[model samples]
Target: MASWQEIEREFAEFAAKVRARFDAGTNKTIATVRRDGAPRISGTELKFEGGEVTFGMMDGSMKLLDVRRDPRIAVHSPTLEPPADDPGSWPGDAKLAGAAVEVEESPDSPVPGAGYFRIDVTEVSLTYLGVPADHLVIESWDAAKGYRRRVRK
Candidate 1:
């Protein structure tokens, strides 16, 4: 498990690009595992605080409860349709997958008693159209392998 800052330190440019994509829009998506071992997707927003990738869930919210029972989760940054006229201009979208660690009323908690957690990020990725707007490019970073890139036609 690595903090967002660790990624930034190791891959500053890639981290900045991912952060910019996340900040460019709102209503990121979250994926959590239900008690039944099923998958759940929900709308959420993220807060980048003190090098932690964090977010909040309303008390008793299903998503919150899901994470409480199973901390494994994945988050996707807000996405946009690439301009048809200039696909090359697309900045790409970001995604992070990891375990959600409860803060337990930490000082950084935005609201008292609210369910807040930071991602112990296991992986982070960015996907976009490549140069010449021909192939698709995927960049990924993980705890074990560090960073990797692949191009798809």
Candidate 2:
């Protein structure tokens, strides 16, 4: 896994784009695993600051409980549809998958008594459609491989 600081340093431009997508909206989607192993999706707001991606939930929130049991998580950036006049104008979608570590709430935390988590990213990806000759472009960054690109027609 890599720290958000590392991602920023290594993939500056790409990271900027991804961060823009996240900043473009207030709510994003987070996927967690239930005790019975089924997937649960929740609406969440995250902060990408102080070299980490962090989020908090109301005390005893189900999603908070879910993360406490299993830290593994996947976060999807808010969806941004392509402009009506230009299908290729879409900025793309971003995803981050990793394990979250429970942390003590900070004084500045959004919810005073909320549970807090700091994400340790294992994978980060951005997907853009109809790019460079009608192909789909997928770019990703990982701790082991650093950076990679894949495309499909």
Q: Which candidate is the best by TM-score?
A: 1
Clashing pairs in 2: none
> Which parts of model 1 have CA positions greater than 4 angstroms off?
106-112
Candidate 2 TM-score versus the reference = 0.93
Tell me the tens digit of each residue's lDDT in model 2 across 1-153: 877888998889988877888888999999999999999999999999898898887888889899999999999999988777877888789999899898887678567657888899998999887554378888898777888989988
lDDT of 2 at 4: 88
Model 2 is weakest, by summed lDDT over 10 consecutive residues, at 127-136
CA RMSD for every model? 1.5, 1.6
- Local accuracy by lDDT, each model: 0.90, 0.88
- For model 1, what is the alpha-carbon lDDT of residue 153? 97
Name the weakest run of 10 consecutive residues (lDDT summed) in model 1: 104-113
Best by lDDT: 1
